[model samples]
Target chain A: MTTPTSGNPRAGGGPDATGKHGRAGERGGAGRGREGDHPGQPGGAPRSLATRQAELVEALTRAKPVPEGFDAVKVAAARVALLRKRAGEVARQWPMLAAGFGDRWKASFSSWAATQPTQGSLRDGWDFARDLDGRGELPAIAGAELAEREARWSYDGSAAPRTRRGPAVRSAAGTFAVQVAGHVRIVRLSYAGTRSRKPST
Target chain B: MGAAVAVAETAYGVGIGWRPEISGFVAGLPGLRFAEVVAESVHAHGDLPDGLPALLDRGVAVVPHGVRLSLGGAEPVDPARVTHLATVAARLRAPLVSEHIAFVRAAGVEAGHLLPIPRSFEAVDAVVANVARTTAELPVPLALEPIAALFDWPDDELSEADFLTEILDRTGALLLLDVANVYANARNRGEDPLDLLNKLPLDRVAYVHVAGGAEHQGLYHDTHTDAVPQEVLDLVTELCARHRPPALILERDGDYPPAPELTAELDAIAAAAGYPAITT
Candidate 1:
């Protein structure tokens, strides 16, 4: 196999005299202190792989600085690709929410999620829909979907949603949903134009 | 633990990935002796998904393929993730469990997808340590899959084959060889895909993965959302000639085609590997 001569030996550990591979110091401090410790383990001493991996992730997710000796364009492309994949997953979980954005869904979702790490598709869509609802910009169909979900489960943004045991009612942008005895019913239709379809929760 | 219950350990013939979106299509496969499910999507303690129980009822061997666990992370593998994987395996009575040799998160951040491991001895050490931690909790054997990398780190010290072989040797793990990944990595690097296949320890292969991909801006992305290309099928044929793995499964994540298209894809994989067409 042909090796890339352009590779920087210091970026990874170079083969040493002892025939042992991966000397932590040879990585140009990439795996310096706290090499085996979990991230944020009380002390501020930076964990090598953990810190560098975070920097790489930050660069990929937040358009932060590309780390030393890495290709900037590749990292940028990965960031966009990741956001696109996330958009597809979120679309699956929140079809109406994604349909509300139409052709602009990818762009709109990417803009909101580019900096945020994924909390899984269900939570990501829920969080995005909630953010839009807060901004008074949620489309009526998505509003109905959100309302139905809100009626059926209680989500605090930071925790997994718990099924609401008792009766509950939720409304968003004129859409109203009612959940009673483990079943949800749309009680009121939104008056927000032709796109306002009640969610079949 | 008495007498070690005789489980269906061998993955035979053709199989397809079980996705919730196409559960019906997967269930309709009469000849499917094996299937794999995303370990994370399964609820360990609750009832299995609608059709999964039916498949299990029919005695189909469903293997839990874990997409997370970050086994190659710098830190020790998370016990919760390993425990969840083990639970899923036991729930399904899986013959074995599989995870990637890649890390999905680091520094308290989730990357949302598998990221490549630098081919350095430190990485091998990290992977081996985590695999040991994970295998200790698993009731079944574990298989490690190498991932398709979009870019390489400047710190790579070992060839891909050596890096992977060393890990498997040290950990005594099985190999989940992905033909599509081999094709993508070779096509992108302008190397002979057969070279890597020749160098790998094919005898360690527990099973193989066949998937589809498309080129984007000069790079072939193994998206698994498209149709399996002819090149990937050809590589599958080449791999079988050297050493035919016990099972080869098709993985389609999204952009699912109709039943006929999917059946045709599965038939193509079976034909390439000289296995009977499960779709028929």
Candidate 2:
């Protein structure tokens, strides 16, 4: 895996390459690498690696322009793969939400999350359900799941959700949920075609 | 990192990654010696997952493997994550803790999956510094696992071997080598996985990971949800021929099959590594 290189700093380098190695390379590369010249650094102090990392993260998660010198095709591929993985994680957290779309879960989640930087799976699923709710596209079962979560916790789309201290009731689509003393009980079970079955909380 | 301490020497043999979904299967492994749990999934202050306590009660090694450390992130590793990992390790009484040499988040954004760092000196430094921060808080030895990436950073300034070796050397951390990753990266890049096995610091490998993957649109992904390809098991054989790692664990994240199927994969890894099967 060690490809011979010309040891040029800007190109790639290797263990046996001529440019730098060992202790000096660690110090010099860490302190004076090209990333040190990034525009976000202050006072011309060695540019923090944080700035370049932020740019890369932006490109990957926010659908921002790929950073210079990166292969657009590969970046796009990575982005798609990342979205797929996120979809899986969110699906695990919101099983019914995913089941609501069934075959379309991966595609639907990927498309929706392309521009959404993850707020973790819990919030990602919640936000997605709310978006569908606003659009009148949420399925009953998933809507019920969302209604339960909303009744139990207070999520403002910013910060982690906090437990509601008081009793709360919420509904979505045709499903209804009530939270008493932090314990949620679903009352109406019209979601997922379970209307005929007696609602079991 | 704090002062380097002597690492525990133990033979873990064949093991599996513990998930609640497949806990029953993992627990039933008759000769299992060690297992790994996702660090973030466990609660530090609460009871261990169902089968995990039984495994621990039988004196099995349950290593806390952290998936979200983002040790390669350019920013300082998050202290809260480090503390939680340390807590999990202490609770499990693990001999070692493992995390990836990749970043999962940056720029105040979560990537939700392991992302590769450039094979550049800058990245090496970032990883080394962050590893130092994490090791300082950990109660046990830390092993770093290199992730399989679908794409390489265009600004990479080193080869895979050099990048990984440099990080291991600087941090003095053990390697949690993934034979599946070696196969995935090599197959994706058209290189020989054996070449990497030859160049790596094999003695430093504390354990190994053998997972499954599938090809999608011409790229082989280390999905861990597919069956372990024969190609990867062959590489395990190749790696063992050079320097057998202390343990080899089967990693199956999702799309779990029946218990017999999972046992067969574990047995296959044991056979490939020339270790005794735990499934008996």
Candidate 3:
């Protein structure tokens, strides 16, 4: 997942060459010879600020252990707070997907997103809905919503979504959505198991 | 760079964050002279959001407050983000723009929220370098805000005040002080908020943010969705007594109350800061 930098400040390589990710070069050689070595490293060599920051972010967003010398309790609180904030943002972006879970939306989103770092609200919800749909647990009411988004835009779950130039039709949970010239229409096909609830206008 | 607008020149009195959910409520403030919009929400080339253009048409000073710039990140500030912020500032004709002294992402992974950076000298260097990069592209003055964090890095080399003072001193950036953040950090850390306030360079404050929060578990979270507690208002009064900022903006992110309740909140801030009520 390391992205190569072009004309980045860190493009000129240095001690960061030993680092794994692209962000390794982000550090402008700050505190190069500081007294306090990185906490938990086998050797006494101090890691760059970029490496430490990346470790902290990994701990918070990717369910990694709290780094040494940090208060586990406080770091746990911060991790929870970050998850709560992400849940709220995603709920705003995918109202139907969130509403379908009712009182469990926050908990459900936190559980699902605890280890998975955010790709922004739009992509987070898209990925979450697609995950639920894969398990055949996607809410009936959200079927049209997901299908409509599928028709209007093409997302590979990695990069930013792009609008479809031609026409597209996508189906989920017996709900069909068609988009042409940027106009989307949802048509639900009635079936014995399908809920009769109308798609959100 | 454009002219460095003196923070003391304009006394904008009282204002609020212009969110799309409360656009009508914000626009109806007859005496409103200032408002803040999230920088990422404003499209540089497209038409402005509803009610924002009207605020600009009426000559309201809307400062573009960025949430994702991650000016305190170890990485250099993204040139594209800085360009968008500068363009949005020009589009709004803002007096200045503000962003937090916190990092939101690292290792190519977004944290999804502002995370506390260590107060070590190394962290300060990173922030200063990032700020320098950001200001180079900015057309207006940049104000750096200190965020409220539930925890502090274990290896902080400097006190909170010292860390912030060094950043502002080195970057020549104005301080967008948040009273609620002051309260939240102090309360969570068992320190006196007034102690930090006294040590900070209040005269450098370009504007102030007043937000609300509630206690979750044993910690007081700076959640803007809740009602503004009375202690935060009292801190506002304390701040103004020392050095009144040019403006104080109320920030309510979600769970918006009715208009009358919001108006009451604005009046309360005005009363605390001794500014004329803009709710009228």
Candidate 4:
């Protein structure tokens, strides 16, 4: 349940990262007109809905404390639900990585992604797989999958991945992959004793 | 009472959300006149996904359902996302497009899924403004759906019906009502699903979503991966008894059942809504 002190660098780089035009003020003004209609923060100037929404989003996605006046237990449930939903999405993008963990995929992905706001499923799976490889915990079958993706796309862990225009070759664990003209071929080098071990069907 | 907008009047009977995994099963459905595709999945240019062109070729009316417009976000909706939706609508020749009333991201951080907004006037204004910006660029009508939220904001100032009505009243947008969402929210909050249905403007329903969910830790999660429970189907029957929407769409996001199970689900929706069975 540890929160990453620094959030994912690629946290919000998708279509959702559109420039923030100064429309918050305009919307705030509209809300200000009806400030007296509701009664919760009755003392000073009312907090704008935009600001409130941003706080809620931060709490939900960043493992920050649940915002004041909200149900802590329900927000906790929502946070868990979001992580589970995200795991399912990443599993779709990286099927082999998910299959590599067998029945533990949901639990593993959920825990790893608990503090990470999604950069989209593709990058999320990539990041998760790379993290597993760093710890020597990545399943060998998933290593082949990771190797193929590395050969096909060039990702710097801080930006959106781009397809490789020229030929590329990459290796991960005991797997090797080569990509030329957008076609990727993976080769898994199995050890003598590990050759017979197969993932549960 | 709002601006004059196109209403969904076509009698598109039992429908399903088209996914790549079940493309063959969906294409094989003999009577499916309506289908919805995630707007983000289709490219604005270039080639459509496999089987999408064939679905379009078969004259199935596809509606682009957007998951990232973040209409309920307090910030202005992204123009590029709107344009992408519009372009996809034009490419698919879709009758209309739909997005959630919930926000997916805020303050440049993606929630990765729909998040509920407060049921307050300010939140309503945000949705209305975003919907205006979106519909201005849309080539067809836009339907806004209320999401099934796990929690309600503490500052909610309006009832669910009132909040949804106000947004719809201002935007003049059609409603993409999800019956499963209605059941989930009501079951979670211990309210009657039929009560909300009684208060909502049923005539504005552009279409209906019927999905499955399972209860987790005393809360009903509207996970489309599960089978459509009998309670959800019963609600569908109740919805049709009051006023049948033009279409009732079966949405299965993951854990896609075998073809026969999927066909049976579609048939069940057809049975509930009194629409002709599309599984033949």
Candidate 5:
């Protein structure tokens, strides 16, 4: 209930039921802002491959086994290598906090990530890749594009990166390239285009 | 020129919608009459807030309302956001400009919400030829507004008030009438908000948006947030007693209530549209 630029969505607390008014109480949504280190700003809404596979299956169910090289792209590059060491104080204070309603709070976080669900764990061990991305329905992006670009639409690719390149790069692929280290925008689709993507489903 | 859209049958009631988050409470709200402003929050508020057009020449009236006019986008209406909202509705002499029958650019991406188009006749002849070529290059009375969809029309052909009365009877323009988005789509599709206000066409309403909706966990959210719901002030007091609206606004983006509770829900929508208290 604050004013002069508050955008309240009930000052961010309740509202995560996932529709039929689970919480369209919608106030300037589009969040992200926690991974702060530097040029790592991405959050103005985009989290749901079921909240990053229930945060990687509750951090792999508090486990400690596979230590030899710890993969999943080295745990998302140790969760974005501390925002690339605070990229020079977020490029000297991100254009004076880009005067709020950053596109209506990133368009109320893609209508609150399209009333969630495709399976959760926002990740711990990624519930066996969140039940194989809720039995193969993954791919709803928020921002992350690769292979010759053009994508940015998101509701949640969770913390992105599912497949990387072509030669049928798995998650049930037909074609999809990556080019970049990973602004990965696959959304598991396979209408068969990026020259038939395949590697191992 | 998109084709021609000047349907100005005199701009109508409680208009003031000027966002930049309420340009300093519309410069301390004294005799506010009409406003639509926005034009991308006044070109991202780079200027034009110092006594906005001398407070719209002390009678308000302002207009220029565009918010990423993807006018059913595919790549045709962003000529630099319609030449910066036709130079801010011709430096604000705006008699009736408007937008949002929905579409906020796609394929080039910018879904800052307001998508839902598909009613068909090729999406109402591509939003009536892009609002008749953007009202022939920003020629006012462009009104549009109606939004409140979760997602429907994967096709029914028409009936979002006959595809907005066939895009205002094939582009003549006008109708910002968002009585809380037609009571948030007849209470989210259960229908009968006066039978979708008797299948719309309230004499081609010119302006009268009255916001504030939120219920959410019950599926309400037209989210202008609290106040303005004695059934949306009896449906804007029955569309100002059947469209006599010439200007009327009480929008509030989120709780800032007490402008005497939005002038007592706009004096109970002008005493259920008996009108009288004309004190602007």
Candidate 6:
């Protein structure tokens, strides 16, 4: 954990902690409050769901029927864990991209939650898909292609923050992108891009 | 009351509760008396640092506190989590373990945030059953906490204080009274925290937890990113004056300026209680 005392890589044309883009404290107009507590919806007749959620949902209605065998509980559990895991992955490898998420990310998440089917079964089904992804239950991507994209996520930031014992190891198990100021840091956890890999039988 | 807490009542002294950003500092600092290390803080991370126990050996009582026990959750307290807490507390030689009076889990679903229980019999039964199970085999008394809540149910059958009083009476658990939470609830919900505390069986107070929160949209979020607000300070000062509990810990999660800022906060605690400053 050799925490560098000075000169962060992301400091390059970067978002200083207090900078407008990545600045955490300044959420006045940005609406950084909880999703449920976000500012009131636009004043007018309510629009259909798509306009509010078009970008975030990815309309998985087309997600090729996943393997049929997983139990409902197993699937939902997998999705919740995966979403948390995916967020964790992002926090690890590409924090910069996460920073790019304006209030929209919160809204996107809210919209996804809002559309949760009225019936418990469908809601459970939705959770199953998410959890599977979180648990890395999905098929593996090609190593080479994953490496290329993963490489693009590299965060050449300033030396890590100094701890009493110097910088602790930044986990490389996944990728997370958080935006600091104007620049985004893509922190990657190292795995040779074997993330989401299934264990060999 | 769940099971007779094996350890005798003791005050470990004043110390700030645990936060991840300060773990290393806490691990190294020996002068601090007690560390209320949140259970999830350890599990969310990993193996407890060996130094943590060593810190205990050096005189710091490291108690494992938790928010997820969801004693009031829709489902029974998870047996696995209870086991984890027991292990953590035993290793730390903690005299007591604590969770909030609220439920953070629901119907087997953990929302990752503490959700308020409707304060009904169903909720009470859920909590009592879980609390009993959590402390079934523990060597320390499992403590219950009062949290600062924003949401409320008009049809809520029980008041927060009444609910807590009943839970303590039924479960016989120790109380981890958070003055800040008491004040927060009083202010936000227009209920009197002191009035609530007055109704409580003070003999159950095993420890006191206090922290800072932010005011937003006519409500205070228990953000804990700053110094203890004056409201809490006033309340604690009064509480300590009347009844000195076993231990008291100051909590600051973010915006931790420097030692002086914390020292000053502690100074106020000392002043309010008419106790001498802790020089160490």
Among residues 3 or more apart in sequence or in different chains, the pairs in candidate 2 whose N, CA or C atoms overlap within 3 Å are A13-B157, A36-A47
lDDT (Cα, 0-100) at A147 in candidate 4 = 82
**Candidate 5 residue runs with Cα over 4 Å from true position:** A1-201, B1-13, B16-30, B36-55, B59-61, B66-68, B84-86, B93-98, B101-151, B155-177, B191-232, B235-280
TM-score result, candidate 2 = 0.86
Q: What is the TM-score of chain A in candidate 2?
A: 0.70
- What local lDDT does model 3 show for residue B229? 99
Candidate 1, superposed: residue stretches over 4 Å from native: A1-47, A165-168, A179-201, B1-11
Each candidate's lDDT (Cα)?
A: 0.79, 0.79, 0.84, 0.83, 0.49, 0.53
The 10 consecutive residues of candidate 3 chain B with the worst lDDT sum are B1-10
State the displacement of the C-alpha of residue B265, model 4, in Å, after optimal TM-score superposition. 1.2
TM-score for candidate 3, residues paired by index? 0.90
Residue-by-residue lDDT tens digits, candidate 1, A1-201: 101111111111211111221223322354433333223334434336655666677677666677654666666766788899999988877888999999999999999998877766777888899899888988877876788788977777765566778898898756787777766676545344333223232
- Candidate rank order under DockQ: 4, 3, 2, 1, 6, 5
lDDT of 6 by residue, A123-197 (tens): 222242233345654222212222222232232222122212221222222444333222224444444332232
Q: Where does candidate 6 stray beyond 4 Å?
A: A1-94, A100-201, B1-8, B24-30, B43-47
Native-referenced DockQ of model 1: 0.21
Estimate, for each residue in B1-280, the C-alpha lDDT of model 3 and write its tens digit: 2244465558999999999899999999999999999998787777777899999999899999998888888888878788889999999999999999999888777787898899999999999999999998888899999999988886788999999999999999999999999999999999999999999998788899999999988999999999999999999999999999999999999999999999999999999999999977
List the candidates' TM-scores in order.
0.85, 0.86, 0.90, 0.89, 0.24, 0.61
Clashing pairs in 4: none
True contacts kept of 2: 0.49
DockQ of each: 0.21, 0.24, 0.34, 0.36, 0.01, 0.04
**Best-matching candidate per DockQ:** 4
Q: Each candidate's chain A: what TM-score?
A: 0.71, 0.70, 0.75, 0.75, 0.17, 0.21
Classified by CAPRI criteria, candidate 2 counts as acceptable
Q: Which one is best on TM-score? A: 3
Model 4: lDDT to the true structure: 0.83
lDDT of 4 by residue, B195-280 (tens): 99999999999999999999889889999999999999999999999998989899999899899899889999999889989987
Candidate 2: tens digits of C-alpha lDDT, residues B1-280: 2312333356779999998889888878889989999987777675666788899989999999998888998878878789989999999988889999898776556776788888888889999999999988998889999999887875677889988899988999989999999999999889998888899999888899999999988889899999999999999998989988878999999899988899889989999999999999
Report each candidate's C-alpha RMSD, comma-separated, in the order given.
10.3, 10.4, 6.3, 6.2, 23.1, 15.5
